[model samples]
Target: MKIDTQGDTIRIYDFNAEECFRIARRLENQSLKLYQGIKAAIKDADIAAALDILIAEELCHLAYCEKALIDMGVDDINAEHLVEVVDTGVVTPLAQADIERVLCNRQEALKLGIALEKRAIAFYESILAETGNEQGRIALGNIIEQERGHRERLQALIS
Candidate 1:
């Protein structure tokens, strides 16, 4: 399955329950890498520490995605397989300009974090819309709620 993103719209092609889980796992991993990259680029100790906490949260989100895959009967959760399943370029919400802003200002980093969480929420909501399975919808809904919470936390930081 593949996700095509154009401007603010996302089109999902040949998506299934298993692919949904795989996509979630891939996005979580991407977000984790983004946080780590931002942490490395910033010199402020306080901002770095805050990013560390976000990194830990992303780790937990990744674990949840892995478990969701396992529960969906995916026996193998290989990183290489996930990469082949979906290209990161299509799913990544942050662009080079956003990353540049994040590196220069802590407030910009928080805004970027909020934007990423909003994108994750939209992705999960899209999955929920595509899914016919009750369990899958419930799972995706839960993930959307979590992303909303993350967005709210980031919003608070910016405020």
Candidate 2:
């Protein structure tokens, strides 16, 4: 299912509630992996420490998505099935190849973190706009607020 953003409205094509939860969980897991990769690659103690915090945040986000799936009546969430869901085209701030370059310095790492948080906030807002389920909307709203807080913390770190 493709999620299209046309002006102010978001169009979710042929997605059921279960599929939506799967997509969300998949995206969160991808982000968690990205943060973990970056944290592993960074050598600077300070940058590594900062990334450690973001890694924890991403893990929490992933858990929240999983909980949302369970709340949607999905008893057993198969990770393989989640990976097969339609690609939502959620972009990470730094690609795998670019991770080394972007995370070379503290400032750059913080900038990447800020960009990632912004993208996550936008993605969740779009999903929230398209979701008809009240529970899903509430979950998305909470996630968005958390992403905003992450962005603000990254901004503070940079400044």
Candidate 3:
């Protein structure tokens, strides 16, 4: 699951529903890979166990993104008729190199987790702000809260 930071980080200020969900799914996949890689690198069982929970959460989120696309009948992203416009960029999770540089210990891993969750929350919030449909706004709100919970859990582990 190698992601090119430059290509994947292209900001799409105006995107339709299909594009939104596809980008979300892509971010979730990146997140899952990051957590899995970190879990593989860490020796401590306790930290690995925590990463397992985060990985599971990311999986659920990814599934939700897929289901959303299905429910919307979005067979393809045409990049036409956007829901709203805003200053939005691709939500980039920590790259492989960033993860490796930061994963010195359990504490550092937890810190990275916090940062990852923060990015997720920010991405959803930005989308939420620009979302015109009530359903989309509600869904984005729920996702933002879930990401916040992930951040709080990592913070508790660090404390």
Candidate 4:
């Protein structure tokens, strides 16, 4: 999306709505898989419950993205984008044991999540730069904030 910046407020528009939506879908899918892995890996009841909650949250995220696409008049939300795939990395399946082992060795998963979020933030920021409009900038900034939230949430889990 394109964005115009004025102080802390930004106005944004002119975004590749389809591309963003596609990215969102892929990211949500990745999150769901990660949580599934964590759920399988963690033997602790509390941790397993927490991972399940995160999985549910990602489901909501996917639904929210779908809704956003519909609201923006972007049809066919499943279309894949090379940028989303390449930039976000391959959607690998994490075994429950592999993810469960992470509770004691959490750095691996935490760092991966952080990297994914960073890439997502950069992608949206780049899109905003392309648009170079007020509304687009605003929208991209909001996305950046959202990515930060993801980072924060993941950090809580890891650290």
Tens digit of per-residue lDDT, candidate 1, span 17-106:
566667677887888888998898889876776677678777877888788788777777784564344554523645788888777777
Per-residue alpha-carbon lDDT of model 2 for 22-130, expressed as tens digits? 6667777777787777777767887787777777777776787678778777777874663345466765434665577556776776677777777777776776666
Tens digit of per-residue lDDT, candidate 3, span 111-159: 7767878877787777666666665566666567767876887798789
Ten contiguous residues minimizing lDDT sum, candidate 3:
81-90
- Which model is ahead, 1 or 3, in terms of TM-score? 1
Candidate with maximal TM-score? 1
Which regions of candidate 3 are displaced past 4 Å? 1-11, 14-18, 73-98, 133-135
Model 4 bad stretches (over 4 Å): 1-15, 79-87, 90-101, 105-119, 126-139, 153-159
Kindly give the stretch of ten consecutive residues in candidate 2 with the minimal lDDT sum: 79-88
RMSD per candidate (Å) reads 4.5, 4.7, 7.1, 8.3
For each candidate, what TM-score against the reference? 0.76, 0.73, 0.65, 0.60
Least accurate 10 contiguous residues by lDDT in model 4: 86-95
Query: What's the C-alpha lDDT at position 59 in model 4?
Result: 79
| Tens digits of per-residue lDDT for model 4, 95-121 | 555544557544655555665566767
Pairs that clash in candidate 1: none
CA lDDT, every model vs. true structure: 0.72, 0.69, 0.67, 0.63
